[model samples]
Target: MTTAPVILDRAAIDAMIGVIEGRGHRVVGPVVRSGAVVLGDLSSTADLPVGISDEQTPGRYRLTARDDEALFGYVVGPSSAKPFLHATGVPVWQGERTADGSFATRKPEAPTPVAFIGIRPCDLAAIGIQDKVFLNGYRDGVYGDRREGVFSVVVNCVEPGGTCFCTSMGTGPRASKGYDIAVTEVIDDEEHWFLAEPGSDAGQEVLAQLGAAPASDDERVRVENLLVDAADRMGRGLDTEGLPEAIKASMESPRWDEIAKRCMACANCTLVCPTCFCATVEDETDLAGLEAQRVRRWDSCFNEEFSYIHGGSLRPSTYARYRQWLTHKLSTWVDQFGEMGCVGCGRCITWCPVGIDITVEAAALAAAAKEATHV
Candidate 1:
């Protein structure tokens, strides 16, 4: 049965982790590493990035200390649920030479189920977008295997980063869906706790195990005010009304050439992006030629060889590659996946070497399209 809104004290976090572990899930959450908050194994609430916050802008990201001892005070760092769900360097299949002159091939076993904690709402949206990419058409066995029975706990964003624009993309500062449980952290002069609500049967059971108490009306109002403030504080926004059509129409815009001058084609944006799921596979054999394995690795459209076929690379120029990447992300992705590829997590803007903001580029293309329409 769906439970009422509950209040979980600071100690309840540790209890929640223990319960998830008790269920045989490898618990992972946000932790401090290399001076940044990234997803890692969680043994207790102490392992979380408590009292830490992040400063993110175009081409920069830094970890800073927060005034309060809020356990989840920081925004998302470079990592997301992507690496865990769609793992890289996975062996698709291995083949061995049999005694007689034949080859025996076998697919790799499915991965163990995992429980994710402290997931941001934008990342939850990103996971949904990836679900469409990997689970819809052919049903990728590897991603499907990893995605099964995975428990997700989403943490609402009450303090968005400088580069974040989830609100503009209709993703969030609040967890709308795709979570087993949702939490909103509250820290003030009086108390520090979480307002938790179950989104699924498993979540209700977990909260019951924690003995979470029913939340009061005051607590609910406080959380609503915090979330509304956070929404107003979003650092950037993209006007997506006619964005896809504008991007598709601006194929010949000179704005691409301007961006190409600073574009490094380093693929850092795709690597950090939660939804850019282009990948390529390779077959390798041992020196003895007795065994062979096919490996699937993440790829990027910015690479010159990515569009290469037998004859030559289709998009050799940096401008053409950039155009292709943006077009696919905002315009063509809707045609392919029924939605935009980006969830507005802002990882690309924060991690780009030259600070090439996708939102700015898209606006430029839209303006160019409007000017052309008037002519």
Candidate 2:
């Protein structure tokens, strides 16, 4: 069930920040750096990307200044909630052998509590996908601990980037879940305030601390109109009605070869994707050869060794590896997690050096399947 929202002018947003930090949570949110919105440590409202906007396309990203003071004028960039929740490189556990020929292992201390601010709906859905992977029967202690204490504040996108298609995925333009507080920023000629709503107990408590007033009917109407405008503004989309079946049917298509011609197997797509969970482990020893540390690092299916077995790799050719990645991400993932692996954040499209858009590839798969049916 949804709760009625409250209104907060731009000034009160800072108070909301203080409320989260007051609870000892390290606030992590978007910051403008190197001409793009990047996630980093945040202290106050000034730390947000104010008057900053971005232009995103396949294989390109450029940041431009907005005329107004709208903090979240742009949509998501390459970064997601993935980094803070699951570090790219983490030490799983370390061990040392004593003189008595015994071994002792020690796990790291629990992660500091994190408060993720300015999250978008699609990325929040990506977080949910990861939860099923990391918190299911076979749990990941590192990711689980970091995920447990997160205080999430989601912001609805009033405008969509050129590569955005969360609407096609049924994930966004408006925030839905996995957030404590959901806010809609409305900056127009007459008003410049946020329509804020709390979705959890912590959110309610924090919102109360901000001393916000009940949202007016006009304010609620403005918020709804913003979402509708965003939906129409989305420039890209993927028709995913029968995506899993389409991918399964298009395996023999020559599209794989076409993609392999351009894909460098750089693994940028997998790295930027919020839900790709493949990782590799390494064992390192000190100069004494007695003390050692076990390191776990994020890995990608694009690597040659990713599909290695006793005899040989499951996918030896470049085309085979690329196909495996696409198939798993769009098809087999649904079988394993009961949902599509993609959350429509467009990170893969924007970050890919070759501008290999997943939506384009998905459409090609459907065309290939159609040709096969005629054959």
Candidate 3:
């Protein structure tokens, strides 16, 4: 059966949080942290980043005050849902020497269930990509349990950031799937409410607890119109018609050298990216070698040592590293996973010190391929 949309006022939102917490899950949502809006623990509706909007461009991010008290006024910030699900510096196992020169090992305890609110549509897509990475084929039990236990509340975009390209990626402006509950915030001179729809049985139960009234047809139409406006306002776009093939054919394109000149290879892009899931494991032991632990920490392809082998590093040049990163994200990933690795969140563009835009580089590659064909 199709679930009816519900209208949630400010008070109802607060009640919704309380109701979720009552179900033994810690509620996390967007909050003003330092100078940006980031996901944090929510004790009440007051913890949300109300009336704050973020301005994002290539190599820039800043928070601005919104004219209205709209709770979900901002797009994404530096953080995504990755840290909660695929955490860094996590201990995989610990070992201790026994009396007879043997070792004992044990895995860490399971993580707590998390209820995430105000997750952007792009981020929701990112989580889906990671699900394939960790939960497909061999399947990572740790990541799977945490991810499966999440109660996600996706907030569709009404105001996209300057670097946003989710619309072009077919990931967002408005969420289509992978959320327990989705909401669109509407605030005007006369009304301030959210048109909420449940995507799962759990979401339906939570809404039932809030006792939120069903939304009218006019309210739903208003939300659809606003989403359309948001899609049209996207700051960037990528033509993905033959993107994977074009990127693969541009293996020797001079564009790599051009991009490498400005590339720092500092791994900031990979570090901030929600879907780049490369990691390295390290084993540590005490001076006496009595106790030791194996830790799995996040790694990046931009690092020189990441490609080190017996003789030397495979990708010794900056151009080679940059090419590898972009090619894998846009081209090779599709071959491996049957989906592109990027969701067009543009965190890499906003956080890069040199402000390198992936969409621009991808477009340039496609253009170069087209010119070559003509010649």
Candidate 4:
């Protein structure tokens, strides 16, 4: 089926806010926070970061103002799309009276419906990768429930981040699917508007309320050009041919030792990664020992306890742990799942305490493999 693209002016976006907020769902989007763009609760179109950009490097981050007011200027920040799917600091319990003398358990509260606005294409791909882990394999009830009531509005990247390599990963620069509505911001001498395309029935309903018209062929061409340009601007790429086998074969390679010496074993990478699904469950009781509750929190493989086995930690050394993480993400992940674990969002590269880059590591491994083959 063919539907004409629509141009959503600033006023049209405001109308969309009314349409969305009028439905009783709170809108979460990008906003300027402490000199950086962060996802938070937004009430109006003006609440978005209009003219700002971010500079991201391994172990460092900085935000800058853009020449023109562009709402989606920045790429991504420390926050991933996970928080929207899996809530943090949720109250799982409340005190209740018990028959004996202690308190009883109360049911967990359900998360409210949320509409995520201005989600990047790479982030959308990351969310899809996570869906394979949580929704496809195990079908987590919490995730399923949260996902059922949520809506996604993705924004196409006009400029790629320095660390970004989504094009190499075949994940982005343009959003082909996964969102309820996909939008590309177009700015020209005379106009600044969003080219909107509805990807689902819900998106269509929202579009109907926004009151947009069919886009011209020139407008469609402009959007395509923007995506292609962004894709070409990617700063990093990975050579994934035989990556899994190469990583498995190089299990005892000296690269691990070299990496470990520079690595600080911090959990920053996992924390920023949208596809990292490791979590731990904790059970806690009140001071009176009457009421108790169980909670699930985000976990990281960088922790020594992550690989604990019967006797002790399987990966006791930092080298072993680093190897396990990189190999799992780039190589073994594809073997376990049909698709690659990473979406090339560059979060790991940007947030690593030691500035360790996975793409560089993979390339080194590939080079080493080639040299060995020749030998």
Model 4, 1-375: lDDT tens per residue? 334579898788878877877876778889878876778998888999878888987767788888887778789887767887765544445565587776677767666778889988888988888788878858876666677767788998888887888887888988878888888998766779899998888888888877788888999998989888888888688877788788877887888899899888888888788888887767777787666777777777889888888999988888988888888888888877787888888889988867899899888877887778789
* Candidate 3 Cα lDDT to native: 0.90
Between candidates 3 and 4, the one scoring higher on lDDT is 3
TM-score list, all predictions: 0.98, 0.97, 0.98, 0.94
The residue-by-residue lDDT of candidate 1 on 1-375, one tens digit each, is: 775889998799889999988988989999999988999999998999989989999998899988888999988899998888888899889999999989999999887788999999999999899999999877997788889988998999999989899999999999888898899999977789899999999999999999778999999999999999999898888989899999988998989999999999999999999999988899999999999999988999988889999999999998998899899999999999999998889999999978999988898899889889999
* Candidate 1: 10-residue stretch with minimal lDDT: 137-146
Q: Which pairs of residues collide in candidate 4?
A: 50-70
lDDT (CA) per prediction? 0.91, 0.88, 0.90, 0.82
lDDT of 2 by residue, 1-375 (tens): 346799997778888888899998999989987877988898888999998889999999999898889877888877888988877677899889988999889998777888988989988898999999999898898798888889999999988998999999889988788899999998866668899999998899899888788998988998998899899888699888888888999888899999999999999999999889889888889998789888888888899888899998888888998898889888999998998899888999999999999999988898778677788
Q: How many residue pairs clash in each candidate?
A: 0, 0, 0, 1
Error of 3 at 249 (Å): 0.9
Poorly placed runs, candidate 2 (over 4 Å): none
Regions of model 3 farther than 4 Å from truth: none
- Give the clashing residue pairs of candidate 1, or none: none
Ranking by TM-score: 1, 3, 2, 4
